[model samples]
Target: VKQIGNTHNREMLPSCWDLTEAVIRHLLNMTDKEFFYWGEYLNEKAKQRQTQYKGPHQVFQENV
Candidate 1:
């Protein structure tokens, strides 16, 4: 569990297994709405990256 600046070093994962497991676990733990909601969150985050956000930003909702 490597943490720097409140972020975990995802690159430290030996392979994609941990990531896949985490996604599967998240899907299994969340409801259908939650799954789609999470997907929207990811989409918004991606957009934020494209927009060149330059501060401590949080993606809390889906982009419209």
Candidate 2:
């Protein structure tokens, strides 16, 4: 929108990460449980792939 100076509500598009981020933020504000749920999901994903990288340093970083 800034590219053309348009001031509309910025139509939500799938490719726009900002839109998804905004929705998650709105939900987080209304319910705190989803906040921890998302963190756990990401943590599980990172943990599952941590060993695939094959580096002690990478594994250590993911543990954090």
Candidate 3:
């Protein structure tokens, strides 16, 4: 998780790590096929968002 944050050049909050760890623990209980499909789904979503992604600050300003 730390490596992922570092790779993205983002500073992850402790709560983010906790949430990720919780999700990982839940994923671990899934069957191998289920886990593989989940990984593919997440990767696809990430790719789809890669081009027009907005940071948190931008989102907040737009909302405000």
Candidate 4:
């Protein structure tokens, strides 16, 4: 049970990481087109993460 919980947590990490990367790029003045592309990628990752996600972050839920 502990291992399964750990694995689920690991699976959810990528979406958060992608979101952080995108936000950092935005702060760095990344182009809108480039940011959109990254957003799309993050959206995909968010969907995948949704399968095992249990967090209450509204951004993920809204985007997903």
TM-score per candidate, chains pooled: 0.46, 0.45, 0.44, 0.37
Give candidate 1 regions above 4 Å deviation.
1-19, 53-64
lDDT of 2 by residue, 2-64 (tens): 467544545543447887898877876865677789778999998778767678888577689
Q: Per-residue lDDT of 1-64 in model 3, one digit per residue for the tens?
A: 3454354444444568788999989988999999899989998887667546777865675679
In lDDT terms, how accurate is model 3? Answer: 0.77
Instruction: Write one digit per residue (lDDT tens) for candidate 4, span 1-64.
Output: 3444466776767787789999787667977787888889999997788766766775666788
lDDT of each: 0.72, 0.74, 0.77, 0.77
lDDT for position 18 in model 1:
81
Candidate 4 residue runs with Cα over 4 Å from true position: 1-26, 52-64
Models ranked on lDDT: 4, 3, 2, 1
Candidate 4 at residue 45, lDDT?
A: 93
Error of 3 at 57 (Å): 19
| Model 4 TM-score, 2 decimals | 0.37
Note the residue pairs that clash in candidate 4. none
Candidates, ranked, TM-score: 1, 2, 3, 4
Root-mean-square deviation of each candidate, in angstroms?
12.0, 6.6, 15.1, 13.1
